[model samples]
Target: MRPLFVIVALSFAPAAYAQEISAVCKYEYTVHDQGQKSGTTGEFSLKATYMLPVGQPLNVQVRTTKAPCYEFLANGDDMQISGTCSRAAQNMKMVYVYKIDRMSGAFEEHFSINDKTGIVHYGHCLPAKPLL
Candidate 1:
């Protein structure tokens, strides 16, 4: 599952979302070509949930990366979280980057591994099954 879409999920955010928020969200996703200027490989219907539990690190299970990451929150308009996932046999590593824009309610995420990268636009925020 791609956990990248948690960025724009506030499409269903609560009324008080602008000032504060708390929830586990699964976002709708569309796959864009990593670097090629042409067609996309395919679409990912299943996405991972993302969360920032107080006093704990950010948590999510991404298909591309397995490492846990930490979220960095600033009081203003931006937030970020990132970590790496690796492939032992290939000796490759993918770095996942998740970003949120509070002012615009925009979410963005991308990861690069094995020379391929992907970015997904999160469409909405709704409750989803917790990652185990």
Candidate 2:
């Protein structure tokens, strides 16, 4: 079975202020086969909320937090956040990466640890868009 520690469910409050960021996005995807063509595949359905202060660096030393965020100039929907979350005190450390681009309010979050060696695709479908 795949390690499930990567899954994090965060409970957040509604926008504390207009610039106080908070959003809940639901994604459904299949468990990716990490280049092992002989293994059986499974699926994952999860709901996660992305939160932070608009245009501010997120530093949550407790569990996990976003570093900072920037979006595509051509369109504001595309974004990426780099961060790190520590577990079991200082014993465990993991760097988290989040990337997503949504045309509308709908969004799909793709997460990977350290690198892209293993990737899972959620409902990341968007209409064909030309690159700038």
Give candidate 2's TM-score: 0.31
In the order shown, the candidates' Cα RMSDs to the true structure are: 9.0, 13.3
Candidate 2 whole-model C-alpha lDDT, 0 to 1: 0.30
lDDT of 1 at 39: 29
Q: Compared with the true structure, what per-residue lDDT tens digits does model 1 show for residues 1-132?
A: 234444434432322222344324334554565533332232122223344342344353333222333333222222433334333335866555554443233344465566675655454233334333
Clashing residue pairs in candidate 2 are: none
CA shift of 13, model 1, Å: 13
Give candidate 1's total backbone clashes. Answer: 3
Residue 92 lDDT in candidate 2 = 35
- Model 2: how far residue 61 lies from native, Å: 11
The residue ranges of model 2 lying beyond 4 angstroms of the native Cα positions read 1-18, 31-94, 102-132
- Model 2 lDDT tens row, 1-132: 122211211112222222112333334553453633222233222222234343444521111122222221111112432233222325433333343332232333334444444444344322222121
- Model 1 TM-score on a 0 to 1 scale: 0.37
